[model samples]
Target: MNDLSGLLGRVGERKDILLVVLLLAVVFMMVLPLPPLLLDILIAVNITISVVLLMMSVYIGSPLQFSVFPAVLLITTLFRLALSVSTTRMILLQADAGQIVNTFGSFVVGGNLVVGIIIFLIITIVQFLVITKGAERVAEVSARFSLDAMPGKQMSIDGDM
Candidate 1:
């Protein structure tokens, strides 16, 4: 149990470091040459989702809470599917009209869409599962103690003291 606690402490430290790195990356992007609107939108979306997931990971006290991780995964997959389908439709229409370069651009954009989404979803699920499992282990260890006065029966009073 001590070993497990130490391991969890290490994991928590690593997650804190990663989160700091993520924040630094967001700051770096703010000063880069990229479009400000796009960067802001992406940063806002990522930060909001990260905050919500981090809170969920901390507050939800059981392994079952990890199940919510898949809901986020599923939402991301659906977004990817929508992006893929819409981009495919745009590419096909452009191709039928002989717009070759635009079609190729669309293909390039859509080709990696699903792959990126899959990779991100996998990473997110793994991280959340680690957090949730550690939390569950801690809960299990702490839950072994009981504070009730009686083991199997209530105290009874007799008529005579």
Candidate 2:
């Protein structure tokens, strides 16, 4: 029971660290003074999600859990695209390219953002998998050690009788 509690506490600590990092990174990105427009919002959202995913990868302590990384990236990318389309429509309806760029920077591309997003997603997934696997290996060894000691404990108890 104590062991389990300690494990849970450690997990919680890691989660807290991840959350803090995500929050700080997102806040910093948002403070860059970009115009309060759709593209700026999308960029902020994507950066936040990516940082969160990266932090999760660092904290999960196993490679098998890395499967979650790609999923996160996919969701973020979809949101980014949806936001981009709407932002583009609004910009076209309201102002010219210079105004849009002044407000949101050159976030819109001829589909390059999507390609870059995909590449980043793939890289994150791979990195997460590797780290998760390493953590799993360590866990496996610890479990085995505990399992091996149990019978010895039982044997000692039997001898005491």
Candidate 3:
């Protein structure tokens, strides 16, 4: 029990270091040639991360509760962009991207390029207009309330002094 607790404590303390290492690995993936199996695994991991983020946003009680969300969002965005670039590179050079892309292109898109593009655009717009806009409004309201409360906070400090 003591050993387990110590291991957990050490992991908790080094979360930032782990995050930095993960970020570096994501950056390196853009420059390396990943095997198809590894690429497929990474793609599945990306989808899982997106689902987790969506669930977190849905269940969060307040914006402040997830103060680190913006950084997480940025990192995920960069990670996805890196994956996109790497996938494109693989396709252009090797003429074979991976099973994930091939499956999506064949099964989801059904070889219909225009339909796939339209679906992609619609998802992007919905994400921007619904999720991003709602979050922005919540952040604005939170900031306004914080500013409005500042005077009372100042008064309390003055009284304490």
Candidate 4:
């Protein structure tokens, strides 16, 4: 009993363990058929985390302040992919995605399929732009760092002779 308690306490302190579990569970979700209720909860959680990440980016003073953004973003992307696959399976096998998706579909469509398609395209474009902008910023920072290090590297080589 004490050993089990110690293992649980260690897990609580180790974020890597949680991340591993999340990745493993996401893989499992792709193969398993999740009930509509669990899918709804995961969808809501993903949206909430995305919103929080957006807020963090908006308020950050520098890119370095959120150095782990890329890893977090990758994890979220995997999560979204897993969710999309799972949702597709549910729709193909059972023809239902859950209440939130149903509500979103109705609200987005509002009786016009054309309008819904247009809205979806616009949203997709906007998402692509946002992701590309972040990628560009990361590239810029990396280039600047490389340039800044060049002088030090040159000096070291010159001194070695």
Candidate 5:
């Protein structure tokens, strides 16, 4: 084990580099092709991570215990995006994504094209509306914060008093 340091060089101390490389790999997936086997493995890992995250959130008593939640969430979101892009590219260019995606499509569509299109549209619209609502809330909070931070507004209130 003494030689382990020279080999891997203290991975625990370089977690930031690991995270950045992982994120870069996710971005590279958008441009690179992935084999079906690797895609299946990645899909499995994504599902496992998502389930673990969900379970932790549900069981945890306080936020402090999972202070890295936001970072994990961001990384997972990017990973999912990359997987989606990669899967779509494979499906369009090679006519195959992976067994996991194929099984999921068959299960969701039930071998019916019309029903699948309808379901896809419904899901897309719901996602779009949810994101729009979240963005609206963020904008409202940002505007309110800006207004509250105005020095002239505070000064004017004090002068009136």
Candidate 6:
């Protein structure tokens, strides 16, 4: 029991170090040439992270409860963009990307390069215009409401005083 507690405590203390290491690894992937197998694994991990983020956003009770969401969003976006650049480099230089890219390119686009590119563009636009914009609007409205309610709240405090 003591050993397990000590291990957990140490792990908790090293979380920041772990995060830095992970960030460095992502940056390294952008510069290094990863094998197809590793690329596939990273792609799968990216998809899993995205799904987990979506679930977290859906199940969170309030925006304040997930205050780190914006940071998480930025990190994930950077990670994905790095992955895209790495994959593009592989495709251009070696003519082989990875299983995940090949599967998506083939299955989603049916081997039509133009259609695949168009679909990717459309999805990006929708995500930005619909999902991101909606979240921003909600945050703006919530802030305005909070400000509007402040006078009433202050009055209540004054009455109690």
- The model with the greatest TM-score is 5
Off by over 4 Å in 6: 1-9, 117-161
Candidate 3: deviation at residue 103, Å? Answer: 1.2
* Deviation of model 1 at 99, angstroms: 34
Give, for candidate 5, the lowest lDDT window spanning 10 residues: 5-14
Ranking by TM-score: 5, 4, 6, 3, 2, 1
Q: What is the lDDT of residue 60 in candidate 4?
A: 100
Writing each residue's lDDT as its tens digit, candidate 4 over 108-143 gives: 799798999999999999999999998999999999
Clashes of 1: 0
Listed in order, each prediction's TM-score against the native is: 0.24, 0.33, 0.65, 0.74, 0.87, 0.68
lDDT of each: 0.57, 0.65, 0.90, 0.95, 0.93, 0.90
**Candidate 3 residue spans exceeding 4 A from truth:** 1-11, 113-161
Candidate 1 residue runs with Cα over 4 Å from true position? 1-35, 71-161
Better model by TM-score, 3 or 5?
A: 5
In the range 1-161, model 1's lDDT, one tens digit per residue, is: 99999988887879767556655554454334333344334435645766887798889889695886876755544433433343344345543222343454356556588775777689899989998998999887676544343443343433233
After superposition, candidate 2 runs with Cα above 4 Å error: 1-42, 58-60, 96-161
In model 2, which range of ten residues has the least summed lDDT?
A: 27-36
lDDT per residue for candidate 6 within 25-140, as digits (tens), equals 88998999888888888889999999999999999999999999988898888889889888998899999998889887789999788998899999999888998888999999
The parts of candidate 4 lying over 4 Å away from their true place are 1-7, 51-73
Tens digit of per-residue lDDT, candidate 2, span 8-117: 88878798676566555445443433333545656566668778877988898677868767655655666555555555555566553234444434443334777667
Candidate 4 vs candidate 5, lDDT winner: 4
Task: Estimate the lDDT of model 1.
Answer: 0.57
* Candidate 6 clash figure, as a count: 0
Error of 4 at 22 (Å): 1.5
lDDT by residue (tens digit), candidate 3, 1-161: 99999998998899988898888999899988887778888889999999999999999999999999999999999889888888888889889889889988898778888999998899899988998889999999999999999999999999999
